[model samples]
Target: EITGLDDKDTVFRTVPSDDYQGRALARTLKEKGYDKVAVAYINNDYGTGLANAFKAEFEAQGGEIAGFAAHEDGKASYRSNLAELSSGGADTLVIFDYGDGTGLTILRQALENGFFEKFVGGDGMKSDAPINELGAENLATFVASSPVGEKSDSLDIFNDAYKAAGGDPDAIFVTTSYDAAFLLALAVEKAGGDKAGVSAALREISNGEGEAILPGEWEKAKKLIAAGTAIDYKGAAGDHNFDAAGDVPGTYALFEVGADGFEVMVEMK
Candidate 1:
C-alpha cells in the first residue's frame, strides 16, 4: 500500500496493506456520523498513502474533507498546521502519523491550541504514548483504527502460547509478526532449504488450497512438507490466504482511549 513492495516476487507480507486500513478508517468515521473532518499526515510514504486513500473514500461516501495537508516530522511546533486544518469548520481531525513520533507532537499541539474538538487516527496513532502523555481523560473523543485478527482456533492457540511465554498476546502486530516468522520457516522447509525457492514455497504453503495447518503444528507441517503434501497455514492472525500479490485482506476495528489503555469500540467493515 505505502511502498508498493508487494509487487516484488520476493516480497510476502503476513500483514494487510494500508489500503485496507485507510478504507476501514473512512468507513468507521462515516458510520459514527462524522460528516466533516480534516486530515493531517506525515510527509512520508506511509502517511501520504493512507491519507490520500482515506480522503478518496470518505469523499466518495458523501463525507466532507474540510482540510488536508502533510507535515515534516520532528517539528517542535505544529500549532500553525493544526490551525490551518481546523480552519474549514471541521470539528474532527484525522491524523496519519506515528503516535510515538511526530504524531505525538502534532497531537499535543492540537490539544493545547484547541484546534479540534474530536480526534481520529490510523493504526500509526494507536499507541500508548498518547494516553500516557496526554492522559486518557483528555482523550475521551479520540479514536483510532487498527487491524484485528479474525477470531479462530488458530488465534486461540497462539494467544495461549504467547501468554505462557510471558508475553502480551494483545500487543500490536504480535500475531502478524509471529505468523511471518512461522511462515518463513514453513517456506524454508517446503523448499528443502533452498533460499531461491523460498518465495515460491511461500505461495504454495498458504494459497488457500491444501491441508490446514494451525499454530503450534510444526511437526505436522514438517511431516506434510516432507511427504510432498500441500499444507495451508491457518495463522494466529488470520488464514493467510495470499493473493497473487502475496497480500492478505485484513479485518479492522475502531478503538478508543480507556482507563487501562486502548479498548475496542466497534469492528470496522
Candidate 2:
C-alpha cells in the first residue's frame, strides 16, 4: 500500500490482472489441445501484460510459441504484421487485442492471409465488433478466455434489475463498476464516514468477514454496521473479496466466439 509506484492506492481495480488472464488463456489452449500457436497483440500495456503471461504459461504447459507480433491500435491494415508473425507457420494464433477497431481489422486480415488455422484470444476478443464485422459464422472457430467469478444469484439479480432499469444486460465490466461503487459506500458506512485511511477500511469490509450482505441490501448492511458487526458484501460481480493488493483472486472461463455472443465452454477457478 505504501511503496507501490504504479497507480497509487487511490486507484483500485475490480478486474483481474492481465497476467492471470493470460495464464488462464494458456491453460485453456492446452486443454483444447492447441500445441503450436502464434501471437498477435496490441503493442501496449494491456496487451503486453497478457502476452507475457500467456507466453510463459503456454510454454510451461508444453505448448510451443510459434511466432509473436505486436501491432499498433487504430490501424486499418495489419496484413504485413500478420504475415510476418504467421511466418512461423502455426496453424493457430494466440491473438491478443481488443475485439474492435484495429483488433477486428487484424483478425479479418489474418484470415485473409489464410495460413493460421484458428485464433485463441482473451477478453479483447470477447467483444462483438469482430463478429459483427467479419460475420460470426466465419469467426466461429475463435477461442477466448475471460476472467470470471463463481456463478451466484447476485449476478442474475443484477442482470434482471439492470435490464429493468434500461441497462444493457450484456454490457461488459459494468457490473464491476457497480460493485466498486457499492463496496466503497459500504466501507464509508462501516467506517462511520469517509474518514482518512478509509481505503484500509474498504479492504476490511470486503474481505469476506462478518454478516453476509448481497447487493441492494443497504439498510441491512447499515444495521449490521451499526450493531458493530462485520459484513461481507457479495456484489453484482459475485463475491468481491479484495486481497492485499486491492485485487481479488482470479477466475476464468473458456468461451467460443459465437454468432450471437460468447458461448462459455468451461470455467476455471
lDDT string for model 1 (1-269, tens) is 42365455787787788877898789788988999999999999899989998999999989999999999989888888898899999999999999999998888888898899999999999998999899999999999988777899999999998999998776688899999999999999999999999989998998888999999899999999899998999999898877777788867889998888889899888
Looking at candidate 1, the ten consecutive residues that score lowest on lDDT are 1-10
Whole-model lDDT per candidate: 0.89, 0.78
Q: What is the TM-score of each predicted model, taking all chains together?
A: 0.96, 0.90
Writing each residue's lDDT as its tens digit, candidate 2 over 151-245 gives: 78877888888888998755556677788888889888877796776777787777877788877888999998899988888877777766656
Q: What residue runs in model 1 are displaced by over 4 Å at the alpha carbon?
A: 1-8
Candidate with the greatest TM-score versus the true structure: 1
Candidate RMSDs in order: 1.5, 2.4
Least lDDT summed over 10 consecutive residues: which range in candidate 2? Answer: 1-10
